[model samples]
Target: MDARQTWSSQLTYILAVAGATVGFGATWRFPYLVGQNGGGAYVLTFCIAMIVIGIPMILVENAIGRRLHINSVDAFGGMANGKKINKAWKIVGWMGLCGAFGIMAYYMVIGGWVLNYIYNIIFGNLNLTSVVSADLTASFYDKSIINAPFAISIATLVFVIINFVILVRGAVAGIEKAAKYLMPILFLLMIGMVIRNLTLDGALEGIKFYLTPDFSKISAKLFIDVLGQVFFALSLGFGVMITLSSFVRKDENLVKTSVITGVLNTLIAVVAGFMIFPSLFTFGVAPDSGPSLVFKSLPIVFSHMFAGEFLAVAFFSLLMIAALTTSLPIYEVLITVLEEKFKIKRLKAIFITLGGIFILGNIPSLMATNLLSDVTVFGKNIFDAYDAISATIFFVLTSLLCAIFVGWVLGDEAKKEILFGSNGAHKIINIWFFYIKYIIPFLILVVFVSSFYDNFIK
Candidate 1:
């Protein structure tokens, strides 16, 4: 492989990773899950999981990448101490790559929805300034976007092309440059939304609902949900962290950077809760509205607020930025695989990967509209099937293998990479190692089985 591309600076690395970690999972999925699973209880469990499980797994991926310093596929098969471990371990990296691709395929469909919303809002197609009723808002999402095949497909194509443009520029000038701008704007939009939402009447009630813990609501199921959320929200187990970290400077502190990435991810999810719940309550909408919370419910809330159109624009723009930042890295994982493993040129790899994604993405996009709405895989539509299989199976399985690889296989070598620039913080390093080695794998196993039960068997 050619000399690996490193981030231009530590700050850029942090921002890039932060962009990867903090995507729609934090901004879109977390709030709804908290509402459904018991607000404060879910948030608390998610935080604990982030500390014990999320951050440690992140450190493990970083260690693997920095130590191996190859693309995800080749990295696993690459040398460790001048010897190759079993090539079967390469499956773990492939799983991560496949999982990332699977996710990006459907993720672009949703990204298209965000793009559609932004365009419609800007063009007066959505008409938020008018006295739109809840039914009208819901209908707009259902009829105009979700069920509109051409609209959704075009938007998805545009979103994919946007990612392609940025990624084609390579890591330093492309991914890092986008992150340098997008991450800050994402935070600013999020904060602005939170400030605006909190000022609404009855906002305090939503805040209370979000923060006041109901201990009685905690359960094994809730914990399982929290586990899945933390993993997905942090973008772990997908080789994203590993691929991004492969470019890190040798002396950078893995522990500090991983923690910072994890913290920023969790912070965005929490802030999303604050931004969303207050608005939901203020508008007399149920917080537990499932995935539609952002698409259907929020629009209704925005229509009633002062400067509702501007807020709608900002909110969807924030969502788009989060989506784009994340899509870039996930898309890069595939591009890197082609470039490193097949010796394909970067430009050719970009076209090949994007073409595949667009083709595969069409399945879900068409399934959402009248064109292929009847199509089903494993008794679920293309979109839900992708989401279920990726989250419940591929994600957990890859994460489990990664934990085993770093914890047991790499062992002390991995520890050395993690501790390289930390000035010998042995105690913390040991603690992190313990969780990665033993606790995290075991916990992921529980989540794996439980996820199967919840998603498939049950």
Candidate 2:
């Protein structure tokens, strides 16, 4: 235990990080967002944001983690080897840890819903049929989620324990191994769904709508949505990239890894568009069903198609895999901090973290039902309140602080370490530094403020 654990290889690191990046953000949210917003235009905006904002921040986080060789809190706590700077900066890491835990709380609830869907499919409990309208799907959500807290709790516990077993095994054997297999299977499932959907009659119409850029639909709102999606999709501001990079061997090229992971994440999201849009059009289903696209509408599509039961199983299975991969890293964010900071054993850290999340996180599940349905905070229910706090507020604030810290405080030291073994290191670092210092931070602030305004005031 004296020696720090590191990923066995660069490939494992890529797969693991990609697994984290490609979860619900790409697999679930991206497709539906494309359907809701201007399909091709939203995708294009997302790509640009990924380059300007996503890649640089990712590199910054990875650089900080690898350079500090510590958990998120201490990573910021020891910046520039200065005591006062370290003490103040530690708050940044704590904010990130809070964001991670906050996200995990509600995220596990959604993960449980996916688990329930998979179970219903297996047990033939869901009598899905025909293409459901947006309202109908919305009604389904109202009828379903959190109606049975016992069942939801069971599913949540199952999800948490699965993560625990994987995390308890340590970095390479646990996370890397799960990512190596799960990522491939997830991709295969996506490819299969896309191919099957494309083969359906009228599928091209959906694809056309998705790929055709309707510039008229582009608005200020769409732009903000794209930026938020890119940030959330890349898992920025969560200290996840930082934690993941801490396990990376020092010789790995941070820029190369960041670019690869970012590109892979975007590509998977685009491909998911092909899968979702085509199926929606082919089945005569409307595209802009918001969040219900996956849980409610997609299953309706499956119910009407050939081999519906099999496809339904595969689709939900894909979601479960995506959710599991994403949740594992967030769990690690807390477990790593607890183990490193408190000097607890890994087993002890896992239980302590899970116990806390288990007790505290499920409040969202309760609020999802009639018991606390009338309860509201900041104009949102408990579940949405948690999401806004973690996903929007904390995430954006943390990313802004990270950009400022790397751009100004870490300064030359970070630049040198980040560029250490790469070709054209100086030029690349200059562009990255420019974005990290000036551009990315500003965009994060805009996203942060706008999100608050839209969620609370406007």
Candidate 3:
């Protein structure tokens, strides 16, 4: 058997976890959600949700993994000796694994799109002008992304190959090293953008829109939206925290680690709001552009900035780094499962996983454009269908099961994990347990039902 692997330090573990949490969403989707949802009020709700729900669950997932010191699937199965534990609970782990795979299948396509844009900017294939319009940017996306199907396929393959190389190198050498450098660079670039954005004329107007709370916007949907953001933004519900924590040294302070990771993730996302909204308002652009906020809308702003070419390079570089950091932990989750369950050699397992993703992912990439545009699953194209299944159904279901398992099934053992080394931790653990058992699961169920309605029923 292979010798056990553990993160060299708490810092590296935190970096890996934070990296997983900070993806493309941190750059674009988060700020957009804040704008559309409730701005400052949404931010306030999200922070509350993170503290009450997100942080506790992070600790719970880590405790399960560190205590068991195994892959997610076996963590539940190993909760008790052999057949004593309900074997069906292991399906929670399977759900997580499947969710990760499903997300990655389409996620790589998005990553490729980022890469293609980066290439266009650097190589002058995309002309960077002083003034750009939404129409112009839309045309560029259509020509480059929608019209060029083979390019996307090649990009996806390249992305899969890149992940395979890093993953095959093992965690410490691959994930840890990448996060150490990439994360800092990502922060620096974001800070630069934040400074540039704040200096823009009418920047404060955007800041006002972002910071001033409109409490009336708070409602059932607001809570649900904030809950979903808190859940997904922290990379919860995917066995990722479990898989990553399995590599953490037991004596490490998981409480501090969880808090720090959650705070940093939220901070970056908030700063991303500053990076986007201020410049958006200064350029006289609307903030409600949704997914196009990143690719279509941002490019117009980028063109208007001083030394726009250099800023564009930095922005895209930051994006690639963000995508890579997020991809690492995801790859680890899938690879660890393959390594444990199939007893396959690490290299062989990497190839097997990548080969499968490469083949399955192409279908989504094609459907995103011309070839399979007519294909629909429950009224969604192949790409959107995969996204809905993973994000809405599998992700929420896994989180609910995790809360149930830790709160009820593990019972006292779970409490011990939460309260392990702290003085006066019992009261806090009690509050956490109550929330996890009752409140958190119910909240997740609301999101699950809402998602189901939007995806299938509505």
Candidate 4:
């Protein structure tokens, strides 16, 4: 098979990347965030916000991927008729490419947490001691808590190794194959957790908190946050979508595939909410749990509940699978950049990238903050700093770039590329051009600039 000719149908392509997008951040954390935002209304607001804004941006992204058939760094270059044609756009590509590196630097630290739980599930008896849970959580952040740093570092490396192995194998085996098998597993586990959580007392409050909307709390910024979360949850800006969509079969329906991705990703998040909120309310654990929601919040809630240990085993396993699936794509982007840029073989690129990232990733050995506080920003820590900056940099630009590319670069050609074999979706295509060209770009620019001021100035 020719390396360039390898491709997946729109279904596999969307699902694979969607699996990456639908990480623990959405499933486990949505309810937690909703709880913080005061209840079901936040989730309610998030849904509307996601569909309206997130979906269109995603469609625009697929257009870039399918049209150019290249990675993020070079996608702009290829579309401009080579790197020299519209040199500035390449900066967009560089931002995305570097964003991928930055994401994995900290993502592995989080992935390490999942890895640590998995290790405890497999070999060691997970001490349900509240003291132990507090100790473990503290270990992740507390310097005086010696075991936490070692555990986080080890877990991060384990995640890096797994990613290196899969990506070195290339797309079919690494992405498509993994997506086919693992997505089902992740979903099934989420469904299982939902079933278990709902059966508990106070579960309905969790459900209501997740699904019911507090109309008064529905503010403009919260709505925007939901929109951004939906996009981030879908992992669109990490450049994985652009890189992965490069492998799509030409005859596939780009619009339909994108819609399907939106639906699947949304469904998983909703399902995860059901799984989490029910358990949360039932346990009298206030649903507004924050970072402690996953590591600290739930474990404490489950300790005194029915079949808590078994459920913990199931929850962590599912969470790990979801994280792993997402981690694979980041690894794919990092290694692809190296191979394409340096003319290195894929295997060598994997090792070089893995070793380099693993070392740099130790910055998050602060996941618990025992020895060092997470590198702080306006009040956020190192992890949030990376998440905020990377998500902001990649997504805000992709939205703007998609608008420019489809509006100007492709123009009439944009319709043709999107409607390539997708002949019937013309109505939406017409609106797409208008949105991409005029409406969205300005919105993206405004939000991008505003966020900078908000973060740095006040």
Q: Pick the candidate with the highest TM-score.
A: 1
Model 3 lDDT, residue 309, Cα:
71
Q: What 10-residue stretch in candidate 2 is worst by lDDT? A: 77-86
User: Please, what is the whole-model Cα lDDT of each candidate in the order they appear?
Assistant: 0.85, 0.82, 0.80, 0.70
Candidate 4, residues 346-404: lDDT per residue as tens digits?
A: 88888877787777654553453544574576676666777677766666676677568
Name model 4 segments beyond 4 Å from true: 79-84, 121-126, 129-147, 362-381
Ranking of all candidate structures by their lDDT, best first: 1, 2, 3, 4
Q: Against the hidden reference, what TM-scores do the models get?
A: 0.97, 0.95, 0.95, 0.90
> Model 1 segments beyond 4 Å from truth?
81-83
lDDT of 1 by residue, 1-458 (tens): 24777898889999999999888899888998998987898898898899888888888889888886788877776555557788999999899987887788788888988999999989998998866777887889888777788888888889888888898789557999999999999999988899998899889999998998899999988987898888788887788888998888888999899889988888889998988998888888888888878888888888888889999999999999999988898888888889988999999999999898788765555564567778877777788777888888888899899889888788788878777788678899898888788788888999999988988887
| lDDT tens readout by residue for model 2, 256-323 | 99889888988888888887888888778878878767887887788778778788889888888988
Task: For residues 10-97, write the lDDT of model 3, one tens digit per residue.
Answer: 7888888888999876875687788677578888888787787788889878877876778888888764422357889899999998
Which regions of candidate 3 are displaced past 4 Å?
Answer: 80-83, 421-424
Model 1 alpha-carbon miss at residue 90, Å = 0.4
So what's the TM-score on candidate 1?
0.97
- Clash counts per candidate, in order, are 0, 0, 0, 16
